[model samples]
Target: MPTRPLSNEVLQKTIDVYIASMRSWTDSAKKLGIARSTLEHRLKVAKRRGMLGPMPKALDGFEVKEYSEQIGKNGEVKSRSTKYSPEGGGQFEVPDGYKIKGESVLTDADGQIRARWVKTKEGEEDPLQVASVVRGAFEGFVAKSPNIWRLKDHDEDSLTVYPLADFHLGMFAWSKETEGPDWDLKIAERVLTETFQELVERAPKSRKAVILGLGDLMHADSHKNQTPGSGNIMDVDTRYQKVLPKLCDIIIQCTEFVRHKHAEVEAEFKAGNHDPASTVAIRTGLDLYYRNDKHMTVNTSPSPFWWHGFGVNMLCGTHGDGAKIKDLPGIMASYKREMWGSSKSCHAFTGHVHHELCTEKDGTRVYSLRAPIPSDAWHSAEGYLSGRSMYGFHFHKDKGSTGRSEVEIL
Candidate 1:
């Protein structure tokens, strides 16, 4: 007989498991043996029929609360319970059609948030649109909008901790000859600065923000093993000067920008396989592969592959060498099982894989960043291709405590 059709309950449960397992629409489709677009269509159908729910249930443990302002009750807000996103973020819409950016609010007696209302240039509100707007607001889940203001000011203890990974700077790219000669470093600096500036724009306005430098800051020399002869192999000192400086400069500017913004903001860095192999080279008789002065936190061998402490929980700077994309979630689960001795979700920023991707592994979010490389080499495909595309992460400060983070393309 043909395979039995799935029951509604079974289908729903299967959908949840499928989503949790894949952590992304494209990967889910691929593993389920369906086309990515086709899988997307099926998911839409499921959502429309109301046979679906947020995988693992979005915002599961967080309670919703309300906060109202005394000024015309002007700044009104709703927020997700603090237990949920750590950031205590919430969403909202103006019923009176008032102009608004982001709001800073506190939880009310009821389990709802009273948003701090802000006046707009000229605007009107429709209650019908308010519910959806509010839902998206609290979660950093924004769609299209005509206007938005950056919101800030919250207690550090009241913020959420997140990982900003997927920065790829240390790789070289042969130009289609874009800028004049020796433009890669310049291009890298520009993009990195732009990204840092954007991050500064988003920092939370509450407490001192804690950061995890995740990994893959540079393309490192590992890729040299991937594509031989496509590039040159220089002495460690020469290559270090070529690529390391650009990355170090970006970090210096980043921390400097942070210091400019907040005196107490703390930033931490980690090493990944994408970093120079010499970073991990063992001194087996006097041969050293690479060495970094004091630029990165985990610059020496026995690289700090993982960082765990304080409220930050865990940090993984591994370059994701020899790991399959589809299997990341399981691998992370195992990492907790073996390495950390705890099951808290692991947040890792891995590089070497250029594609932009995200997945829920065990409990953590594993993001494969789109690097900020200035070469045409990574642009090639099975067919024909030219030009380049790159991206990076910007962790915007919220208040004095936690901050909001975003992804920007360069």
Candidate 2:
């Protein structure tokens, strides 16, 4: 028969046998069926750690269920191991700056409960602190001096609207991968700026102009490079820190450009599924940039629905990610009852499908504008394709939609 290896239990028995034999090493080794050297080493370890009789209990708030010690041949303790569990009915407090990742509780056959918790460092930024940082940065920024431009001849009763939808500024798409035109931050900026300049030059000289950002102005809301609500991974052009400031710059440049063309300019950015928080940042940045300018009005509302009344024409807009398109007419009617009741014509605009759709029901005309951005990898792979274009709508105070200008991307 093979002899069993030495353990803490064997060591305790050996200690007792040695004492019973008047501390004789040879007698203890013979009785335990171990080598005399092994008995001597284990005894030295037991004496060194004072663990000769029984294992020590765990400290407060913890219970050591199992204990082990490895001793070397040279009468030295090599290592000690312990398995600890939270005490029964004990509260486990997660350390500061940490969050519980997972937890489990096991009830032993003796009806004693053992609890285990795994914690991870919390990494998400607080929204309030992020907003505070953005607000502070914008507040401290010294805006450039406004360019002095004389007002040109413009039609007082007309309002021109530049609808920018699904610009997807931070998106990245390769021509080979998506089977579409290559797009990135640089291309998007150039295409949108040039398109807006062309549209502005061709459209009628209206006294009031509106820069309407229908939604998805930014591709990803944060550095996670994922859809804000769905958490779907996205192909992004750059980091969020870079994209946000650039987004603000683009809007400011466009607004400044249009300010020179019209007598009064108003801008509103609607929240979208892709960029609910980013829309707030853009609107806040715009408001801060033009707060001193008398000719500019930037709507800083975080509302999902927005409306503007130009004489008898009621212009209503939403991101269109929520609420069925057909239901929008009724929604607008209920939300803007006064405007809907008084207006001669009502027009509602939305952006989400990345394609143009027009429907008129119950006296309200709802148009889903086409996005200027090219199809990304996911859309291309899914066989979703649409012509990329933006529109400029001109409306008269008494008439709804006098004319439209389209800039189609090739």
Candidate 3:
């Protein structure tokens, strides 16, 4: 038989178990694949290297049960008598250095019972620390849902949805360097609010409005000026401290404006590559800001995709950074199965390509929105000078899409 090379972890475990068992060297060596003399040498070397520690106090009357059973395809069980081995051993004396920290019972493909366990080194990994790390991930989310206000002369006519993807709010650019209009935090504020106003003005009166903050609403993830997920250095207008409060004010302004025109407003947010964590923070802020006001519903969830419904229309969107266009229709359908099934018309929107694109797959229509923000140095150098634009779709109560309004940046 080919000798399976033992790792340091396994060797240490084996030596510890041998000492704890108080078994003969010959018996332990035969059970393991090594010769009796080799086992003795390894034990001496392990002690010298400080890999073999003092044996743990033996558990009194701790008996281990062992049995084997093979089941046929026809559900006939056959019991077989076999020699007992350790939990992780094939034919060797199983190492007992590590106790069962935790275990989960599972069934494998062959319909056999399997036990999965988390094993740590002796006196390592505090249970309290493990629990604290797991607990830290959850943020207390309570739906302080307020009553939605309807338009005074509200006719269930149409709904307007703005696709505000890839805002990249704190991005910086110089006209002389990029040969395009200069961009910064100030310009971002203007373009987003102004374009949103123009888009709303051009659209028909609606009972409700959706002001979508697609993703990447910030250029830098942290105060140190790095991309959110990639950690790449980015061009920035100012410190995150200066931009954070101002950007939150800008969104509040947009939503407040929308609320005036429509009776109800649903402010939806999607996290982008440039501002994943920031997006969630911004959304949570918005949720708190309008918690008392009943005219708006704030959705600042950190999920990649979101869906909103209007009568017969099902509107879905993603950041467009992770998924391709062709896969979106199926993905949306799969994720929003009940919504997809019930709605007659499905319209999907995405951002991050910076250019506008439209395609139809199956019965779904996918629209890749054009960002209204001006190009930074990298986009300009790469010749990605797609015209800056924003789009708002008007959804009829029963007829699906009636029309769309677009505002362009010169």
Candidate order by decreasing lDDT: 2, 3, 1
Candidate 2 Cα misplacement greater than 4 A, ranges: 1-151
For residue 67, give model 3's deviation from the true position in Å.
Answer: 99
lDDT string for model 2 (169-199, tens) is: 8999999999999999998888887777667
What is the lDDT, from 0 to 100, of the residue 322 in candidate 2? 91
The sequence of per-residue lDDT tens digits that candidate 1 reaches over residues 7-123 is 355445547756687557766766677776655555543443344532222232232222222333555443322212322333344555556544454544442333444444446
What is the Cα-based lDDT of residue 146 in candidate 1? Answer: 14
lDDT for model 3 comes to 0.74
Q: Highest TM-score: give the candidate number.
A: 2
TM-score of each: 0.42, 0.63, 0.62
Instruction: Estimate the Cα RMSD of every predicted model relative to the unseen true structure.
Output: 35.7, 22.1, 26.2
Error of 2 at 288 (Å): 0.5
- Per-residue lDDT of candidate 3, residues 137-229 (tens digit): 655754322222334775467898977787787889999989999988887887787777666666666887898887877777779788867
| Model 3 TM-score, all chains together | 0.62
Scored against the true structure, residue 117 in model 2 reaches a CA lDDT of 47
Weakest 10 consecutive residues of candidate 2 by summed lDDT: 1-10
